[model samples]
Target chain A: MSAVVITVTSGKGGVGKTTATANISTALAAMGKKVVAIDADIGLRNLDVVMGLENRIVYNLVDVVEGTCRLRQAMIKDKYLPELYLIPAAQSRDKTALTPGDMIELTNQMREDFDYILIDSPAGIEQGFKNAIAPADRVLIVTTPEVSAVRDADRIIGLIEAEGKYSSDLVVNRVRVDLVRRGDMLSTEDVVDVLAISLIGVVPDDESIIISTNQGRPAVLQNGSLAGQAFRDIAARLTGQTVPFMELDGHDSFMKRLSKLFKL
Target chain B: MPNDRIKIKGTSNGLVITLGAGAWPRLVEELDALLGERASFFKGGRVALRVGARLLSTADIEAVGQVLSKHHVTLWAVESEAEETRTAAAELGLEVELEPRPISPEQSRPTAGDTILIRRTLRSGQVVEFPGNVVVIGDVNPGAEIRAGGNVVVWGRLRGAVHAGMNEELGEMAVVCALDMSPSHLRIGDYLALSPADDSRTQIVPEMAFVHDRQIVAEPWSV
Candidate 1:
């Protein structure tokens, strides 16, 4: 079956691009779909560590692109899900090592074998980012609720549109609803107002998410993680399932819940 | 020396860089250096090239195109006197010639009373600069910038930096207005005004900004 190549990108670093890629791919795989994740950040390879496939990477994306190894040789099977795989980036090489054509060629070979190919793009709008987006059938822009992240997401949306890729869904990650309720942080609406894009997911800031990430078990596989549920909802939407946006606050005051309910 | 070899003129289509007779490689190097100096101005711009009587192969035109692309400029058409140069440019799918705007004594410069209408959003890091007035029909996000020699107007939200009456002696006469007047900063001629650090206004109103008493002041638009 042909796979839909979805490039997950964030213009600003530290905005959960790699984390989202790992979790979303894992969630999709757990749903009985074949999935693969490619880390396009060559020099700063972290997706392997995030995916807990660091030790399993003998051949990388550069090796596959340079024909030093077979494409199947570079695919590292996921630890938690048999249906998921990851093509790690080459830690020693820079973004210049892989061209846009190489990325397109690599994804094209994987398309026949997988249901979804999620490319974790580098932080900047450089060669790495371009390579990741060149073959994308869809784009998912990840951003935090902060103004800088939202602004960068807007910039990424513009660049994607310029590339003739018309559709991009926004993923607001690491949002602190407490701060948002206190009127201290930007709300999801504020971000969507500035970005003017479709909101696919809003992953709340959770301490357990960091813990699960450190253990190489993405929170999506965890039992009681709010961020995990948010990513699961994202995956559910991706698979053509209608999942409503979950309430981030489990302990919101009754007044707040009532107001939210009324608004909905 | 570079100015003598290379000349930049803005036509109705876009900027045109006219190259004097020289060795191909040296001319290309000179053009690259000139563009690198004003890289920001040329970025996201599409320009034509006028190679006077100089024969170019497809590779030569492509080499120049590579240089322009390095600076985020696009080479769309090539104006050449030599038939060989025109044929090479055409072979590479470049327009051999643009519909020339005849120059007149009164219209020696195309900037006079000229205004460009931009119909799309200017996202972060996108910039629009013109020697005449500028009007944008969409929002200008925070890292975007607009520079105009005359008046500036945005029909939607404007939250970017804008410089009106840019490099013009009649800078104070240039006015800037938008439906929402939130901007990073405003510059009219030499005057500068910084937006407040906190955006407390929940309501958005169409406001016009102009220089008053040697300072830029924005007021709610009237009429």
Candidate 2:
């Protein structure tokens, strides 16, 4: 099966690029699709830690590229999904150790083995960033609803366009729906207006996400979580499903509850 | 200096690098030597090579650009008689001109301030800033900005921030028009108007904004 290589990037750090990669990869694999997750953040390898596969990494992406080990030897299979695997980045090596050509060749070799390949890109708009995006058939930009995050997302979108990849979509993470209703936080509409790109997902601010991430299990595997549901919806949309966005506060009103019951 | 070659003059607009007809790599080496001779002088200068009759391809143009950029010079335009060279320059976002614009006394005089027509929709985060009249044929999405020195016109929806008649020299008069006008913020001269929260109601019709009684006011398109 051929893989669709998608790079998850945020121009600024801490906007949840790695988290989105883990969750989306988990969600897609749960749907019975073979998925491979690659951590492109060379020196700062956190995707492995987040996925709870840190100890399983004997060889890494650098080893595969350097011919020190076979490609399959570096892949650490996921604990939950048999079809899911992760190729962790090398913690000791620097970003300069690999070139954009190396990444393209690596992902090209992986396309035959998986249905989806998610590359967790490092922060910034430098060589590391270019290396991550070089092999991407699609891009998923993650940003918080804050002004700084949205502005950086705009710059990143412009850079992606400059690279002649126009199919990049956005994912708004950590949106507090309560603050949006109170006019305190930026709404999905506000962000979509600023970035001017197609929205793929809107994940609410869920405390469970933080807890589950610390436990090395992404929240997307937990059923009924709002953030998990958003990730699942994103996966469905990626698969060309037309799933409508869920109302996070559907239990707040009786009328909303009635509408939810009948699925009207 | 031993191998005689064509003369080139670098100007403010672009580089006028000259090349002599000879062996390909030798001519290219001569070109590089000329550029390295005045590296500081060509810094930040866009290059428009003047190749007299050289058949050059896309790869040739791109290689020169890479070499020039390493020396902090930008290849902006090219002047060539070869059809292949001109086509290659255009593909690389460079302008190919047969003759440069003459800067005679009359030609040096500033032309009348002209309007720039923007045909595409200005999406969010896109800023259109110009010193002359600006016309947009498409929607100005919210968070986008348009700062103009003269009148601004939008044939489509204008929901972004706009400042018309900016710059003190432009005087205290400006006009803005849109088919559906509900801008997040609108400024005419020095006055500002914050759009209402329910912009949906105010955006469904044609409107114009101008300074009336020293206040920024929105009026019906016909009025």
Cα shift from native, residue B10, model 1 (Å): 29
Model 2: per-residue Cα lDDT over B4-119, one tens digit each = 55477756654577765333444566667777887888777766677765546567778777878888887767677644355456556576763555543243222225465766
Q: What interface RMSD does each of the candidate structures achieve?
A: 13.6, 14.0
**Among these predicted structures, which one has the highest DockQ?**
1
Query: Which residue runs of candidate 2 sit more than 4 Å off their true CA positions?
Result: A251-264, B1-222
Best by lDDT: 1
RMSD for each model, in Å, please? 10.5, 10.2
lDDT of each: 0.85, 0.79
**Best candidate according to TM-score:** 1
Docking class of 2: incorrect
**DockQ (Cα-based) for each candidate:** 0.14, 0.06
lDDT of 1 at B102: 60
